[model samples]
Target: MSDVILLAPHDDVAVATRDLVPGESVTTGDGESDGNPTVVVVRDRVPRGHKVALRDLPLGSEVRKYGQVIGRTTRPVPAGSQVHVHNLEMPRMPDVPGASDAASDYAYATEHRELPVPEGERPTFLGYRRADGRVGTRNYVAIVTSVNCSASTARFVADQFRGRALAQFPHVDGVVALTHGSGCGLVPTSEGGRTLLRTLRGYAAHPNVGGVLVLGLGCEMLQVDALVAEAGIPADTLVRRLVIQETGGIRATVRAAVAEIEAMLPELDARRREVCDVSDLVLGLNCGGSDGYSGITANPALGVASDLLVAYGARSVLAETPEVYGAEHLLTRRAVSPEVGRRLIDRIAWWREYAAAGGGTLDNNPSPGNKAGGLTTILEKSLGAVAKAGSADLAAVYQYAEPIDTPGLGFMDTPGYDPVSVTGLVAGGATVVVFTTGRGSVLGCKPSPSIKVATNTAMYLRMHEDMDLNAGRIVDGTASLAEVGREIFDLVLAVASGRETVSEELDLGQDEFQPWLLGTVT
Candidate 1:
């Protein structure tokens, strides 16, 4: 076993594969590139999954990892020293001149050509086809709340069918009450209200939801009739509408809602999963509870799967705008057109102002857990996060909760919060979500199934019940990057075909439906 791993030839630091005591000599391991194989004496106690300086660095000198600038030295450091936030700091790089002002130096074309999926390996999964010509991976009965005041009533309605009540309808995945924190307090005509309405309508009209019963309080700013009208719910669609105020209160509303759902059960259960092409799939890429090994293992492997999805003519959506802070430039280079690239850059600028208004900065990331896992700066974290997108050309940029109509890889603007981010992805029409985490993140999106990939073997073994796949084997040499990636792609197809994931087995999606509440609450 090797003691250290160097990701790239020009990297000035190497990652510690295991704990190293001072005065011990370490050699480059098989896990990394073979450029820097010389042994270096340990000058400090370096923990596993952390970085160690391979050479001396002076103050303000840029440190390189993944062949990119992660940060700069805060003070002079000797060889073999452990690199971390205390010794390194994020570099404040000025925005590129005219990059956002116009399409200056924008090529609008690149070497981004699609590769062919092997003829024998073209895959398909069983799915439910909807009236709108969209396909869904899961068949669910959705109870949507029009306002926070009616959330409890909606949940109660869904709860009536909790146990063996839905066993008769095996085709139905589950009865889910999709609730949120905002709906009545905001200005209904404001940007925040419009955004909220868009999200609710998206979920109500989602193909995955076989039947919907919209629950509302009669006096909220957002009216149920308006949402239904804007969402274009057809008369033939299996949908019901009810207001608690009109239904005589919580008990009456729950009874009415249960009766309504019962009437729709047979219709929802009649819909069965049929074979669908890979092109019918739309994958949402997200990462949370990230750690040092995330970039080296799961992220890059997931990137391979993303590229494969793109090759199959499917859509892949990458999100978390703040998390992509420093690495937005790399994505811009892969933009399908100059306009798409500029849209991404503009989103970056918007995030800067957005963060400032909240009395925060983009660099205020890499939470305490991230720092403990050897990630020292948001620049470093962002660089790792972008690996999940692979090298596919970014075809479009979308605002939060906006519809995604493109067929290739695209970017959706979202905050770094996990639930909020996934919520936006689902609203954007992502049929399935693939999330990679180094520290265990057990998460699931209601309408879309989430497949969690673990970055390190240790965490995977510890949380086997919560994780779907072990990507950490790439770092341990048990599997190559492509091998694990293929496994993920296969698992995705299986899950889309009605297979249950860890989070699904635990019944973890209903409480995770969080919409991004943009603007003020009042």
Candidate 2:
């Protein structure tokens, strides 16, 4: 094979698929060794899976990939030099949400979700119907304690609702023990502390929630009444708050909380689900423990599936901003407008500063698991990560924990932490999720269902119980990416309509409801 490889024909740079030895005679395109075309070795070592400027590009010129500019070059670069952090810069764009002129980007899709599925369509699942008319694949009630001092009581109360003992409340999903370390040790007026309280309140009032009984130590930074007032949920929502100090300490609090929850069991058990459209579904596209085949098999499959959901008017979300460093140009071109594209570029730039302020580089990603999976750099990993967005036109992008109401393919700003990222998506209104993994992340989001797709067969078999579908078959040469994509699309509809994912099956969303903490408190 030739030493140089162009990713996209109209792009400005080519990435080295393998190491280029010193003075090795190689052609830029096809393997024809011409007498003279153009040649330059700008470095003693050009690592595999790194980018090499395809031509001698001058400083301040745009570095194009996926036929769009990813960033700008800071200094003149040689034809074969590696383009990276030292010389490349992610541009700054403002954070204002700009309006985009509506246009059709789905002309290629002849089939819409409104079209009838052919005969033998088996898209069905048993789901729960909330009071607000939203359907849930899993039914869960959370014993949310607003204070760390009452955490033990919350856990003790949740224990009563576990396993087969929960059969009496058949309509109620699983019960969760939601507690945290922050209701103390900080100023009650602090934004950081207040944001945490709002996050906890949001969880208490989430639509998937059947009922919530808040426990408090009565003197924490986040008081139960404050959480209740901030959440603004109606008393008829089967939610209640109890204070340990007011209830005469821990034992009294647990007894009083259990009595309060048990009182609503009969009412909550009366709720039922009806047929709902796939459009009611908001799906989060995520990847973790990724490998080489993640981009090839699972990620692309998820992307294709995401497009299918968008066709049906379903909301599909892509997150992990840091993971998508190098391959952002593709998304920028697909942005709903130049303004939306600029906002995304700006976020990328801000993250670069954020990383540097803490003494790190934006390229310091691609964890050991990613490396073991044959991904050599952030660029390589991001190229694969972008596939989860599929072929849909980029619709909207939101910051971490911000409300996401717009449908179609959307991007949410979030860190690369699997649990935290998924939490933001669920909070932003994704009722179901499709998570792709090559390295086997045992991630599960209950209440809002999660479907895990494995990149390769080995990891799938090793973590079968945690994983729901096997996209690895595509990499094994037994199935095509489209086939798996179709399967995932069907599964999304099933889960949306009422089927349970493995994580939901295991009552696994108990500890995953965490909010993204942004900026330090003064």
Question: Candidates' lDDT values, in order?
Answer: 0.87, 0.72
Candidate 1, 470-515: lDDT as tens digits? 9988878889999998899899899999999999998888999999
- Relative to the true structure, candidate 2 reaches a TM of 0.76
Residues 101-198 of candidate 2: C-alpha lDDT, one tens digit per residue: 11122122222233233355333444555555555554567777776788788889988878897687777777788776667776666656755665
Clashing pairs in 1: none
What TM-score would each prediction reach against the true structure?
0.96, 0.76
Model 1 worst lDDT run, 10 consecutive residues? 96-105
Q: Please give the range of 10 consecutive residues that has the lowest summed lDDT in model 2.
A: 98-107
Which regions in candidate 1 have their CA more than 4 angstroms from the true location? 29-36, 95-111, 232-236
Quote the lDDT for 502 in model 2. 88
User: Total backbone clashes of model 1?
Assistant: 0
